[model samples]
Target: MSYALTLEEMTPALRVLRLIAAECAHLPAPFVHLTPIEPERLELSLHDVDLTGDTFNVFELWREALGIDPDQVTFRVQGNGRTRVLRATGPYGGADVTLTAYADAPAAVTTTTGGAA
Candidate 1:
């Protein structure tokens, strides 16, 4: 089996969303939503986060590791910092996924970020 969407087909923002969601799937509660809030803005919501854990902020790490610009994205962490939902606008389009399904059969997309590949 293969992913319906390929790495070459995803935009930079979409790839970031998928990467973060996959990265945080190991948390007590994993990411479950990736929705578009506007024409160019997208949001990713997680079910839980480890506040006391050193991995609370996956944004900076993923952002830096992926080289995503701050101007293109924003984040809203709720539930006493135990839950986080990242928002990005610019390149992500119509990228929404179920954490369980995705984690089970994740799309084979390259981690490379920025520009055309």
Candidate 2:
């Protein structure tokens, strides 16, 4: 019997993403949103996450793990009652990353043609 086999080498950023996912086993959501920002960037938006509490601040923890400095982080809170909190964006290995967590539901920052969102 012949079995199919698939393989692809993991990039440094991807490897780190895997590690982060593994560490998030204790978190609420798993793999909520992932947007490819053309060319070489990725935006990971998570909703209903603990935005203020330091007990489970996944974003900051991820920043530390990704070797991103605190000052380099851009803290943004847009939208109304359901704030769109985005603060972790930096160069990690081979990807430009923005891994944010929202206290409520979050909409995708942009769309294919650009901004219908």
Candidate 3:
């Protein structure tokens, strides 16, 4: 991924993000972010985070926390790996919830240059 959303742990618009944070307290620490300009799209992205277990497990945990049905999630391929996105609306108005879970980036491969034409 070329970009990442970063935000300090602060109260977001309407406490919508805090609400979700409180709701998911049972899960391991999760980073939550809301665009100041566009508060409607709330996201919980797990990229570099260390969950101490399977990363995709967050999908299951979130489903239970948000009361989302298992079959409703959308799965798609992203590069050599995969991504799971669950789009949800409402625990409050003006909030478009999105949860994206993916495994760690593959380690860098070293290359050696030798021959010249």
Candidate 4:
């Protein structure tokens, strides 16, 4: 599967995914992937995340990475799966970022932020 994400529209969650992926570059292929399900969501995954020497939760890191308010993003874990769905929104733009395992195929990650226009 593939996600339609532009660099200009990259969200904090997306940036976090990129940072994690780059940091874990020593891993094998398909270690990480980011996909835009709709205008509001993106998908990401890594085989493993080293929590060593980290003082912030995923949301905090994402917030700092994206330079957005924590309220602008919401995270949800789908069932008992390893995937994580991040719903992000702002005055500029919004997106969903999903992080899961390589074995699990990408899903239709979608989101909508703010009140209806």
Candidate 5:
């Protein structure tokens, strides 16, 4: 996929996100909130994700993780019953990373609008 950050730069950040996802695996929430902190810094938080100082651009992370030219990554939260969560998803390779909360759930979610940086 076309990306501004090379695979080298994007790798560590993507791993950080994956690690966060792993840590949050047990969480019923299926999403991560990408909030811009400064010019390019963004904070990713799960349902109970504590907003910390650590931040990374959402688009850069996704491009590396998914390894595809994404049309766009969608960030959204779904609430059902007593469950509410933030998530991110995008097209990667041939399949799409779909993050949803329901009787049947998918992988993961977030929001970014633009071409590859």
Candidate 6:
């Protein structure tokens, strides 16, 4: 999957991730961790997740934190099956990141008969 986001979009995306990280930091053990490997990219890993909040909440929180128009930033998700593409848009910059749910192919199925027919 591929995406095209502007610099403006990237600002809020990063902000939201940071906010989430901060909130989780207070927890005894957080489910997700965000590590910035590059200036424009972050790595998010989840150990446990709470589904109490929806994606919109994240977007709103990001908007409030970044002091930007909620509509200015947009996030999109797309993929074929296991892999997904997430794109964020903002004023300063935008970024696209791909997430693979299953990095390896599924194991093949086999049929058994009386012996090995």
Question: lDDT per prediction?
Answer: 0.42, 0.55, 0.58, 0.45, 0.38, 0.38
Total colliding residue pairs, candidate 5: 10
TM-score of structure candidate 6: 0.29
**Predicted candidate 3 versus true structure: per-residue lDDT over 1-117, tens digit per residue:** 322434532234446667766776777655676665554567776553544746667666765676656566766556555343334332342466666666654455867799863
**Each model's backbone clash number:** 0, 0, 0, 8, 10, 11
Q: Residue-wise lDDT of candidate 1 within 1-117, one digit each (tens)?
A: 444554355454466566655765553444433333321233443322445443335444434443456675654555555444554433322443322101112234658888888
Tens digit of per-residue lDDT, candidate 4, span 1-117: 666567656565465555645764454333334445453444443333434422124434443444556666555666566455554443212344443332222466768889885
TM-score of each: 0.30, 0.50, 0.57, 0.30, 0.26, 0.29
Worst 10 residues of 4 by lDDT: 47-56
Model 5 C-alpha lDDT per residue in residues 1-117, reported as the tens digit of each score: 334555445444455456646654443333543222221222343332223311223333433444434444343434533343334455432223443222212334556789875
Badly placed stretches (over 4 Å) of model 5 are 1-3, 30-42, 46-117
Name the runs in model 4 displaced over 4 angstroms.
1-48, 52-59, 80-86, 89-117
lDDT of 5: 0.38
Worst 10 residues of 1 by lDDT: 97-106
Quality of model 2 by C-alpha lDDT: 0.55
Judged by TM-score, which candidate is best? 3
Error of 6 at 84 (Å): 8.6
Greater-TM-score candidate between 3 and 4:
3
After superposing candidate 1, which stretches have Cα over 4 Å from the reference?
1-30, 34-43, 51-56, 75-86, 90-117
lDDT of 3: 0.58
TM-score of 2: 0.50
Compare candidates 3 and 6 on lDDT and give the better one: 3
